[model samples]
Target: MKFSIERGALLRAVARAQSVVERRNTIPILANVLIEAEGDEVHFRATDLDIEVVDKAPAKVERAGATTVNAVTFHEIVRKLPDGALVNLTDDGASGRLSVEAGRSHFALATLPRQDFPVMANAEYSANFAAPAPVLRRLFDKSKFAISTEETRYYLNGVYMHVAEANSGRVLRCVATDGHRLARIDAGLPDGAETMPGVIVPRKAVNELRKLLEDDDMEIAVSVSETKIRFATPEITLTSKVIDGTFPDYTRVIPTNNQKRLEVDASDFAKAVDRVATVSSERSRAVKLQLDEDRLILSVNAPDAGNAEEELVVAYSDEKLEIGFNAKYLLEIASQVDRENAVFLFNSSGDPTLMREGSDDSAVYVVMPMRV
Candidate 1:
């Protein structure tokens, strides 16, 4: 393929495609993005068999053809090209190498047959819907921190996205839990989305989709089937195979009748959790929360190291309660509440506790407590 594309445009397109390509690959073609030029546009497609991303940009096409080159080498060459220069990509169809020329920089990279690229077969999506970028972004951002990394429980490694009944009628939801804690979020349901199938999107796909939902007002077109799901913006389309297993019954883990309430500033709680956890052992970061009347003292004690304590004034009228929870877990969940206060609902020192943003029910969370 022969095409003359601007340096900036080429860099942006290649960078996006290459970021999806891992550093190491068993298959040679999997490490390269197929570059095709026709008419006035250049298309770049990259895939790892399970996940495929295609990006397109405007280019000056001299010859409508296609070729493949190492994604990393092509990206590095384009990145080093002088600013504002024009880049020309040419393949003679016989040399088996693609030549990249831009100003004083030039590269000749080995090419692979475009036919070797594995593209996902088109599917008849059972459901197709659109959501505002901000809405989709909120669903992932608030829950991603809690995604499980346990490979055995593959279903817990991704956010569970589906339709649910909320106080305000039906709403779209995203829930993720590692059994220790869970993050459940809800947003207004979009049109034509009530019948959408519940999909346990793999962790990697959620991260890739985040990059496309940065613009708050941009609308994303989402297509779903039993085994694969697709999320697309105006310029890019990302397709991936969904996890085949069923997610655990996460609702049973979220507490419902916790009565002891503690309300404290979210930032203050997070800072205290961070400081106290530093003194505890890495394997057992149990921070003891000593609450009495309106005074709350958070402390962590490790035999080998030292102890740390931070006191904060809260709005708790309950009797004295001492509870221990994983410091890392507390810190992570506390950071998610983007408000002045975080309300904790506790049953006892050992029972699972619930947390929320002040009195808001839009987004709720549950954290299992640890024994001191």
Candidate 2:
């Protein structure tokens, strides 16, 4: 197989492919990317058994054939090549090596038979829809931070994407929780997505998908089935198996009756929590929030490390309440608020507290309280 592609285009495609390739591989072919040259475009495909990524770049295909080479090595070589230089890749079926040439640099990488590459089986999607890149980015970025890393409860290790009934009617919702905190974000439902089945997108897949959402004007085509989910664009395609377990019933944990409302500037609140928590023990980086009338005081106490406190004025009219929460969780949750003010609703020190943008119910967060 032989192809000539621009250095920039080749590097971008190979970089994405290499990321999908596992560094430690039990199978030889799985560690390599399948490079196929044909029909004026070259395709680079890589997989780690569970997730597969295919990147296409325009190229001059002089020979129509396919081969596999170490994804990381190919990416490194292309990345170091001079920018704007044309890269040529050639493989003669019997040489057992793929030749990479660019300007004054040349290298030959060991090759694997493309026939051994495992392509994920295609699924009959139950729902297919198109969503703007920005919309999809917000849904995943906001909720992904809360995805649980615990392996035993495998279902909680991904963001749950499904259709839900919001106050304004049907909307697309993404929810993620690790028991300590939860993020739930909603976007307007796209056409033809009404019958979409809820799917738990794995953490790795969520991160890989982020690379595709950088273009604000791009529209992503999403396909979902019972077992697989696929996101595709004009030049790249990402597919992964959905988690096999059912996510916990999260609605039960979102506080509905929390009456105490405290509206505070999110940036200031996050910075205050960060500063005071510096004195807390590493094991328990907890910050206590004291609320009364229009005043809120954040303090952290650690017997061995000393203590720190910060006070801020907020809009609070309900009865006084004191609650403790992990400083990291508070910082992450607070940063998600794009608006100036973040509203916190509290029921008691023992119950989970709820937070959201000033008056926007579209994106909400629930954080469990800890003992001070």
lDDT (CA) per prediction: 0.88, 0.94
lDDT of 2 by residue, 79-131 (tens): 88998999989999999999999888989999988889898998999999999
**Model 1 worst lDDT window (10 residues):** 276-285
Error of 1 at 361 (Å): 1.5
* Span of ten consecutive residues with least summed lDDT in model 2: 277-286
After aligning candidate 2 to the native by TM-score, how far in Å is the CA of 288 from where it should be? 0.6
In every candidate, how many clashes are there? 0, 0
Model 1: per-residue Cα lDDT over 283-348, one tens digit each: 557999999899899998887898899999998998789999988889889998987899999989
Per-candidate TM-scores read 0.97, 0.99
The residue pairs found clashing in candidate 2 are none
Residue 70, model 2, lDDT: 91
